[model samples]
Target: MTKVDILAFGVHPDDVELGCSGTIIASVQQGKKVAIVDLTQGELGTRGTVETRYKEAADAARIMGVDWRENLKMEDGFFQINEANIRKVITAIRKYQPEIILCNALEDRHPDHGRSSQLVEEAAFMSGLRKIETSLDGVAQDAWRPKYVFHYIQDRYLKPDFVFDISAHMQQKIAAVQAYTTQFYTTQTADDEPQTYISTPDFLETVKARALMLGKRIGVRYAEGYLTKKMVGVTDFNSFVQETT
Candidate 1:
């Protein structure tokens, strides 16, 4: 079985890239194994076809240097948070047994983001229950829960519990986001598709502006913000203290 240090979950193909690609790139650079699991193919998106989105997602994964990426093929707009969906997520959680799990924002402009966040949060908790049986490829799987679950900030601004400095990875993060050519703006694109909120140049600028605002909070050039339901503990206090000299 392939094990990873971090497992990121998104409701749509580009959600992870939009929210936390910088963080993903930074983690990968630090020699951490990371994988991304998209809950849906983003078939309902106005900008691209399911096939196109899949290709874009794969390209983005490569740009971010993730170890692996998979799609659960869940219903785009109507996937329910039931036992069936929970079990599916649990199976992946056990299969990889990641130490940290990153998920969609708890609330966002997109309804799927919030719903998927709740689903993943509940599933992560239930994954630790030994009585909940799950198997993969005819082999009984063991229950495994991540040590930490973090929600990445997406469209709407929410106070972050913590932020990660990703200044060095900002360029790579932009590359990953640009990989979704059909969904984002590019001078090369022919005017064949209707312009959506995300396909405009302003959208990309807004993304950068948000990153700048978050980075300013920590005196960095760029960063990604995250929220946690539980209190996070650190082994060293001096590690967070800014140097005056």
Candidate 2:
């Protein structure tokens, strides 16, 4: 079985890259094994087809240096929080047995983002329940739950419980997002396709601006914000001190 230190989930292919790729890059640089699980192929997206998005997601995963990437093949706009879907997510959680799980924002501009967040959160909890049996490839699996569950900020600005300093990985993060040529503004993309909200140049600029704003809060050049259901504890005050220039 493949084990990872962190498992990140997103409702769409580019969601993880747009929201938390910087953090993922930084974590991998720190020798932590990370994986990505996209809930859908983004078939309902206005721009790219499912095949294009899958290819883009694979390229983004490569840029982020993730151990693996998987798609649940769920309905893009209408997947429900039912028993079947919950079991699917639970099986993945048990399979990877990650130390931490990062998921979509609890509240976001996209309805799927919020719904998927809740679904992942609930499944993470249920994954630890021994009575709720789950198996992988006909082999019985053991119950496993991550030590921490964090929601990455996306689209809407919510007060973050904590922020990760990803200053060094910001450029790589942008590169990962840019991997989705059909989704974001890029010089290579032709004008034939109808432009959407995210296809505009200003959208990318706004992403940078948000990162700058969050970085300012944590005294860093760039950072990614996250929300946690439970209050996180620190081992010491020294870790919180800002570095001297």
The candidate that wins on lDDT is 2
Against the true structure, what is each candidate's TM-score?
A: 0.97, 0.98
Per-residue CA lDDT of model 1 for 82-110, tens digit only, reads 99999999999998899999999999989
Give the candidate number with the greatest TM-score.
2
Evaluate model 2: give its lDDT.
0.93
Alpha-carbon local distance difference test for all models = 0.92, 0.93
Report clash pairs, candidate 1. Answer: none
Model 2: residue 99 alpha-carbon error in angstroms: 0.9
Error of 2 at 238 (Å): 2.7
**Which regions of candidate 2 are displaced past 4 Å?**
241-245
